[model samples]
Target chain A: MTDPDTDRHNAKMAKKKAARDKIMATKTDEKGLVIVHTGKGKGKSSSAFGMIFRCIAHDMPCAVVQFIKGGMGTGERDLIIKNFSDLCDFHTMGEGFTWETQDKSRDIEMAQAAWAKAKELIADPVNRMVLLDEINIAIRYDYVDVAEVVTFLRDHKPPMTHVVLTGRNAREELIELADLVTEMELVKHPFRSGVKAQAGVEF
Target chain B: MTDPDTDRHNAKMAKKKAARDKIMATKTDEKGLVIVHTGKGKGKSSSAFGMIFRCIAHDMPCAVVQFIKGGMGTGERDLIIKNFSDLCDFHTMGEGFTWETQDKSRDIEMAQAAWAKAKELIADPVNRMVLLDEINIAIRYDYVDVAEVVTFLRDHKPPMTHVVLTGRNAREELIELADLVTEMELVKHPFRSGVKAQAGVEF
Candidate 1:
């Protein structure tokens, strides 16, 4: 005779599998996504970069337009630009964080220039994925107009091109428009405990 | 004469640099970290893989032990095992998720086997990073003991070997002992919007 425990477990799994299968069956549509990563924590931009790497692994063309983070080079940036230069378009557009720059008008000018570049990338049909790094922070600081950005994202983005916006304080309107949004919440940080960011891990 | 805008920006950056330099000077100690990624959103395991990729790019050795994902082949698992076999010690230990397996004793046995492999990797001083993918889900289902795991992580892991645990429902003690913790909150998800998991994006 079959074991009673095994029989019970199999039955439960079968039921769950049926439910999952039904759900999976109903999802057949495919389209590019408007993805957003935000909140007061680390890894927002890193996660976006992870997606870009995934796209590159699949031989998809990708572009990154960094805003508000231009003071130094990072290991990820260096490696991607060095190795995957043909598959990836890497751009560092910001002068620095607002607190470092300390000039509102100049920040706005830089943000506008970055947005223009972002628009150009978005319009390119060959780009399968485009990452707007720290664009949320630019919108939060009023360096970029949220309304116009939302309008452009909704109306002008290529239909099959995935776009990722990453930074803290993502606008609510942007969140509403995004197909997927993940908020990276800070639970505990080594920085608060006097640990400095390292090269391979935090850069 | 320098442009006023450029001069003001330079002065502000210098002041910020001074503050940053002071903080950087105090952080001289470097040690391995226990990083936890948990919550209701996605990207926990993907972020860990990103770190592994980063380590591989830096020519650092890494290991991964997958506990509760075993039914199907994923792009990441296939690609890493095929391409970076030398640098990555990849292990998929669990038969599948608990619900899918539906065998408590079998699940516990598999978890124990996975832990054995993890211990071996942890003992190896050559590994610079170790990713315990879905170990939290195993512990959550009572397949593994949290206290024992924590004790081992605290006392046995190599000093410079970074360990990453990724899954939902991370235990409070684990969180307390971790150097960095990120909770990925679900703001929005395409799965909820009836989009099925895709190849490059999801896997």
Candidate 2:
């Protein structure tokens, strides 16, 4: 006993629902933006690694460009050198650490190479996530162009791709543009005790 | 200026130094092993990701097999989903954690598939590093064979390829043989305040 107008309206609603479902089915999302982990604290890169695990939980690919520490002697690095290449693209800068490298020019050169590789990843549409590990410290050291980095990320971000920047001394402009930013303050560290970093712990 | 016998001794010493230098130059150890990050702490895989950055500094490779988290709408996962298929080989158990999985049998099935991949890497002689990620927690859940894992690691560990296993409740036997062990105790957690995990911090 419904009126013709009511029946037609119900029919229109059904069509609209169908159209929404169709859009949902066919939609392809470009990835998200960037996450920056910084501050003079502990566990910045550690936080980024947690994201890697989360991404992998769903079988997403991830890439890492480590800028600060390039040592091959650490146990953790040893493990990655042996295994994660297949899971993710991993590139290390040549310098171990600024304090450890002892030569400032040498450290900057290594950082530049790492940045070159990292730049390629950030530009690629296929790379969903890129972690610029410890590049903040390099920026602080005047090793690379902070302005260039900020501009590149804003201009060249891929659809659906996300990047994470980690290190001490994240610049203010970079933090402002980041989708998320964290600062870790170190209350204590075993290093102050003159204890050498154990293989698996610090590295 | 020395006698003929003394000159010969000096020549031998110089030759020994040269040979040592040559060996160092020719060594294939540009990379090291991959870590299997596990544990119940707030940031086990986070630590691993930090190391991934370290590996990239050396232009090395790394693999991460994420277990016990997946199929949910997570900001981190969505951000990196684009990268999982190629540059990084990531497999999420899709079962979430033990409490969340609710079905014990399902967890075991998923964990077995994960271990299959881990076993392959563990047995491979050429993989620079292999990160099992959470096999230790799986073992605690009765998802994997502790004995089999121990045997495989002991007998099949490739020369120069190192493995890092992280997780809470790591069996004493596994600890005994580890070249390095780091115990991360939870001092405080957001969950205590009834805060759900943030996308970047806990993902």
Best by DockQ: 1
Q: What tens digits encode model 1's per-residue C-alpha lDDT throughout A96-152?
A: 887677666788899999999999999998999999999988998777899999999
Candidate 1 lDDT tens digits, B1-203: 56886677668767887898788788776788999989987667766776777787787888989986752225567657866789989999988877666666788899999989998998899999998888998888667899989999999999998998888999998999999999999889887767776655775
Comparing only chain B with the true structure, the TM-scores of all models are 0.93, 0.70
Off by over 4 Å in 1: A1-6, A70-73, A101-106, B1-21, B70-73, B103-105
The DockQ for candidate 2, computed on C-alphas, is 0.07
Cα TM-score per model: 0.89, 0.47
Off by over 4 Å in 2: A1-31, A70-74, B1-45, B48-202
Which 10-residue window in model 2 chain B sums to the lowest lDDT? B29-38
Give the clash count for model 2.
Answer: 46
Docking outcome class, model 2? incorrect
What is the per-residue lDDT of model 2 for residues A46-88, given as tens digits with 9 covering 90 to 100? 6576566555454567788888665322443444446555556
Error of 2 at A148 (Å): 0.3
Q: Alpha-carbon error at A127 in model 2, in Å?
A: 1.4
Deviation in Å, model 1, residue A19 alpha carbon: 2.0
Model 2 chain A worst lDDT run, 10 consecutive residues: A192-201
